[model samples]
Target: MDHIEGEPCQDIEDCRLTDRHVQTLLNREADELARHFTGTFSPETVRDCVEDSYTHLAATARIRTHLPVLAARFARQRLEATAKNQGATMSDEPEVLFVCVHNAGRSQMAAALLDHHAAGRVTVRSAGSAPADTINPAVIEAMNEIGLDLTKEFPKPLTTEAVQAADVVITMGCGDACPIFPGKRYLDWQLDDPAGKDVDQVRPIRDEIDRRVRTLLDELVPSNA
Candidate 1:
């Protein structure tokens, strides 16, 4: 059997350590790990990303030699993502903000598809030049066909804040109403507004958006995925 030293379990019976004890041990372990975790990390990156990793370490700290390996993996991933973001003016990943007259149909569908396919590799936002009452029914139906969920998403208004927040702003038939700002990148996707289109027509629009989404992912993200 393996032998280890240091503190033992408290009055809690099972293997779970006492809360206070864990917190104290966590602070010590964090200090120990700092020697390796620091350096070359991005200043803009949030500290919680590295600090929170040690919160559960008290239970495993008896053999802390294993932590350096895990810390290396975490540090590498965080550093790479930070590096990819440093080159961009807005989002760490290419943030594509989709806008239309009402954010119910075209823009919502585009954003949802991209988020589904790209996941962590891409940042996506969708809003309307003028907010809509609710998401279009047909749009939800079409998206459900592909197993994408938009339950938590809602129509948001276009504003200087939202546009400036994005790396790429795509407008779909929003006319001149779309927010414009100096030095902000823009694209007008002439996708036939899906507001009242039949399922057949909207299907093609979804397909085209998917293709563009894939291409954008290839260019912006490190992987072909």
Candidate 2:
């Protein structure tokens, strides 16, 4: 669903996160990384990367069920890429492209969250496989709940240039719509479509997205910077 559509949901529950949940997710992720990098990298490196990845995502994610697996996969891909590109001179800024069917809801929200949380550390963009005319209204309200104004954000069509420019290309159930480029990281987020859901339903989706976005930013623009 585009951000231009949807009804606001009242009686929104206060979404709070807990420390145990975060630690558990990280532990699983670290285990996943260990399996992949056991002999290639030291345990300390794997543990540190796993913790960083979890910290980045857990802060904003509202849904915890699949977070650990997602975090592990994401962290693994990033670590692999970083290892491959060691000693290479990379751009100071990392560009991430978020894509979905309409570019109205998920992609827009993800882009905005990354930008908001990154604070100029990352270059964020969003586009749709089939572009929509306006932002989803329900999505706008959901973001507004967190003091993020997405009224100015509009749906954009996917472009070769945009995809090529991105250091990472993330698709939210967009299927095979996004083009494949060599040496670029790609991820597909299996998220629910917010088309017919009310603002209440959208809230949790938004929160979960924020968590993923935060985690992505941590990887792209490290805390040390």
Candidate 3:
């Protein structure tokens, strides 16, 4: 995963936080995560995941108020991926990861569409080489118009564990950023970036992604199978 150099605190409230305060919050989050991943991971591992997730998300976060919550969610995802990599959790469903430059537009759209179409038949994740602070508003609007909600979705940094856990890795435009591993299927979809575009402009891109997602779904989980 690419690291963006910066302090984690960017918002006004975040700027007011002391190092101790941030550490305390992270410790609390790690405790909760440790309980959730009890049998699968150790406390130290959980704490490290939490701290790393916080740093990754905090680097691009525009608001610090919800940093802990977001960090928890991100850490959980990474831990789950790590579990999959370590064979701690087994799944028959295919795991897919979508990567792009800024997880704000193309990658996010593809992930949501694939999840919707998969309907729990497949596991989906998305990340970026350089994540944005928030999801692209136009992408959100376009997805919403199709009955998919993305208001809670945020950009996530790409991670080695995420790639290692995935059975299929799709790259939108991040190009050479995604790490390659043997036996994993890789596909590059040349899609237009939705940043700075309005909802109308994003709709076509969303539809195209939907079409591609459906095609991929057929290959991964065929109707006959």
- TM-score of every prediction relative to native: 0.57, 0.60, 0.91
- Candidate 1 — which pairs collide? none
Q: Could you tell me the lDDT of residue 40 within candidate 3?
A: 96
**lDDT of model 3 at residue 50?**
84
Model 1 alpha-carbon drift over 4 Å, by segment? 1-91, 222-225
lDDT of 2 by residue, 28-116 (tens): 67876787776677767777766655444443344445555655654665565455355323556888989999888999999899889
The total of clashing pairs for model 3 equals 0
Tens-digit lDDT track of model 1 for 114-218? 888888777777777765646777777778888987654556555554576577788888998766767668888888777778677678888888888777667
**Cα misplacement distance, residue 79 of candidate 2 (Å):** 31
Query: Which prediction has the highest lDDT against the true structure?
Result: 3
Model 3: which residue pairs collide?
A: none
Candidate 3, residues 53-108: lDDT per residue as tens digits? 88778867866667877888999999999998888999999999999999999999
* Cα RMSD of predicted structure 2: 16.9
Residue 78 lDDT, candidate 1, scale 0-100: 41
Q: How far in Å is the alpha carbon of 87 misplaced in model 2?
A: 20
Q: Least lDDT summed over 10 consecutive residues: which range in candidate 1?
A: 8-17
Candidate 1 lDDT at 45 equals 38
- Point out the higher-scoring one by TM-score: 2 or 3: 3
